[model samples]
Target: MKRRWLLSLMAGLALMAAASAQAADPVRIGFAISKTGLFAAGTGSQFDTYNFWKDQVNARGGLDVKGVKRPIEFVWYDDQSDPGKAVQIYEKLITSDKVDLLLAPWGTPAHIAVSGVVERYKFPMVGDSAASVKLRELKPGNLWFTTAVMPDRFGPVIADALKANGLKTVAVLTPQLPFALEVKSFLMPALKKNDIEVKVNEEYPPSIKDMTSLLINVKNANPDAVLVFSYPADSTLYMKQARENGIAAPFQFVMVGATESWFTKQFGAATDGIVTMGHWSPKVAAWKKAQPFFDAYEKQFHEAPDYLDSALAYMSCEILEQAVAKAGLDKDGIRKEISTETFETINGPVKFNGVENATTPASLLQIQGKSMELIWPPSIATAKFEKKPAWPAN
Candidate 1:
C-alpha cells in the first residue's frame, strides 16, 4: 500500500512539471485605435491590415524570440478618435494589462497624447499613421519610430508637381490638424520658391460639415490650383461641395480621400483628373514585391487597401518583427536597434534620418477612368497627367 501511494504521488508531481513546461506565454502587443469615430475610416483599414499581419505571423508559429517561437496576441481598445480616451487606454495597457510591446495609435493627435505614456513606460513603439514634424521636435528619445512619410518631404514633392504642371497660383484649404498645418507650413516656402502665388488660404475645423462658403470663396479666387489638406470625410465633403459649386481649378490637389476606392466609387467619373498623394501603387518599382502585397491585401480584405494605411500597417509590423528578432524581446534593445538600423520593408528601405523621421517617397496620382494613375515623378509614373474638364454646372 505504501509503495503504490508513493508511485501515485510521483506521477502527480511529474504531470504538474510537464504542464508548467508546456504553458509558454504569448508575445502580447497592445495599442488603442479608432474603431469608431472621426478617424474610423482610416483606422478601419489599419486595423484590418494589423490583423492580417497577425494572422500571417501566427500561421508561421509567431515571432521568434531568441530561438523559440512564441504565439502573438494583441490587447487593444477603441479610442473613438479621442486623444484623451487614447491616453487613458494606453496607460491601462502599460500598467494593468502589461503588454509585452506597444504600437502607436491611429493619427497624429492620438499618437501625441499617448506618446507621453509610452515614454514613461519606455516601450518600443512603432507609429504607423502619425507624421507631424512636431514629433521630431519633441525629442522623444527614440522610444517612438514613425512609419509614415513626414510632411516636410511632402511639400517639396507637391511643389515639384505644381511647377511641372505649369500651375502658377494656388489656394489652400486645410484642416486645423498638426500634420496638415505642418504640411501647409512646409508647402508655403516651397510654393513661394517655385513662383506659385497663393491667392487664398483657409483653415477649417475638422467637425465642420458645410464647406459651401469655403468653396464659393475659392471659386471666386479662381487660382490655377487648389490644394485641400484634410482627412477622408472632410476631403469628401470638400470635393462634393467643390463639384456642386462649380469650383474647378486647372489643378486640384487633394491630400486624402482621392486615393481611396470608396472615394472613387462615391464620385464615379467625377473623380477623374483630381490629383492626390499616393505612397504605394502596384506600379511602383521601388518595391518589386508591392504587387504581391497589393494582391494579398485585396484578397484578404475584399476591397482595395488604402495605400497609406495598408503600407504603414504592414511595414510597421515588419519592422517590429525584425527588431524583435535582432534584439531578443528587450524593449530597450529593440528601441536601440530600431533607431539605429534601416529596415527593409514592403515600402522599400526605410532609414531614419535626424529627428526620428524616415523617408518614404511620395508620388502624386491622378484618377483616370476610375483608376489611380501615378502622374508625377515621371521616372516612376504609371500614367501621364490628364487635364481636368471644367466643373459641371451645379
Candidate 2:
C-alpha cells in the first residue's frame, strides 16, 4: 500500500512538471512589414520600435500570460511595401508558419489587403499605422483593431485651425493612395463648409518626383494656406521646392513631416511653423506615461523616438501584451478581450469604439525652434498657434 501511494505521488509531480514546462514555452507572434520599397522610410522606425518592445519584454523574462511567463518570439517577413506581397506573406504566416498571434503591416492599403485574411482565419490583429475610413466601412469583423486616429477626426481640427487663423483660401495636394484620398475627401468638404476656398485640389502619383510645376501652379493660386498630404519623402521635397520656388503661404501644413524627428533634423529652421497631424509628443501632460518608453527607446536605438510611427508601434504591442495576459493563449479570447477592454498605453487610455477603432484624439503639431509642439486641441496644447507662420529666409 505504501509503495503504491508513493508511485501515485510521483506521477502527480510528473504531470505538474509537464504542465509547467508547456506553460513556459515561447509564444510566437508573426507579421509581414515593409523593409524596402515605397513604404520603407515610413515603416523603418515602426519596425525598430517593435524590435525594441520585444527586447524589453524578453529582458524582463517575457510576457506573462495567465500567471505563467512565456518567452515571446517574433516571426516576421519583409513585404517589400507591396500590398500583394503583404497579403501573400500574411496568409503564410497564419496557415504555414502558424504564428500564435498576428500584427498588421504598415499602411492603409496593406492593412485593407490583409484584413480579409485575418478575418477568415479569426486571428486577432492590431494595426499601428492604418487610418482610412474605408477600413471602418468594410466592417472587417471584430478581430482587427487600429491605433491610428481616423481622418474624420483630424479633418475638422485642421478646418477649425484654418478658420481660427482667418485663412480664407487653401490649396491641397495629395498622393493618389487610398489613405491620402480618404483624408482629402474629408478635408475638402470641411474646408469648404468652414467658408474656406480650396483654390487647387490636386492629386499626384505616388512616384512623382518633379513637383516644381505643381508648386508653381499652387504659387500662382496664392492661397492663404497650402496643405500637402503625402508621405515623408514627398512632403520634404514639396517643402524644399516650395522654399526654392519662393512659394510662401501664411500657413503650410504637411500630413507627414513635422511628427518625424528626421524631418526637423533635415529641414532645421525651415520646418518652423509647419503644421502636421501627430499622434503623440513628450510635451503633452497626457503623454507622461510615455516618458519611460521614450527614454528606453532612445537608450536602446540611439535616437529620439519618431512619435508618429514608433509611438503607435509601441502602443499596439502594449495592447497585445495586455490582451494576451488577460485572455491567455486563445486567439478568440484575446480578440474579445481587446474589443471589450480599455488598454492603458503610453498614449493614455485607449478604448476601442464600436468599429474596432481606437478612440484617441489627434494633435496638430507645429515645428517651433527644433522641436515639434502640440498647438491645437486646448486640452493637450503645449503652445498657442502662431497666427502667421514665420517663414525662413530663402
Provide backbone clash counts, one per model. 0, 0
lDDT score, candidate 2, position 132: 73
State the lDDT of candidate 2 residue by residue for 1-394, as single tens digits. Answer: 9999999999999999899786667888898889899878778787888888888989999888977887888999999989999999989998999888876688878988888888788787888787877767655444454454588877877888888878899999998888778778888888889999989988899887889989988999999999998887798788788888887887888886557667777877888788887767776677667888888888887778887878888888998999988898798788788888888888888888755555667668777766667787777778877743555785
Which residue pairs collide, candidate 2? none
lDDT agreement of model 1 with the native? 0.81
RMSD, candidate 1, Å = 4.5
Candidate 1's TM-score: 0.89
| Leading candidate by TM-score | 2
- Candidate 1: residue 251 lDDT (0-100): 85
Task: Give stretches of model 1 more than 4 Å off.
Answer: 1-24, 145-148, 389-394
Deviation (Å) of 274 in candidate 1: 2.1
Worst 10 residues of 1 by lDDT: 140-149
For each candidate, what is the lDDT?
0.81, 0.81
TM-score for every candidate vs. truth? 0.89, 0.90
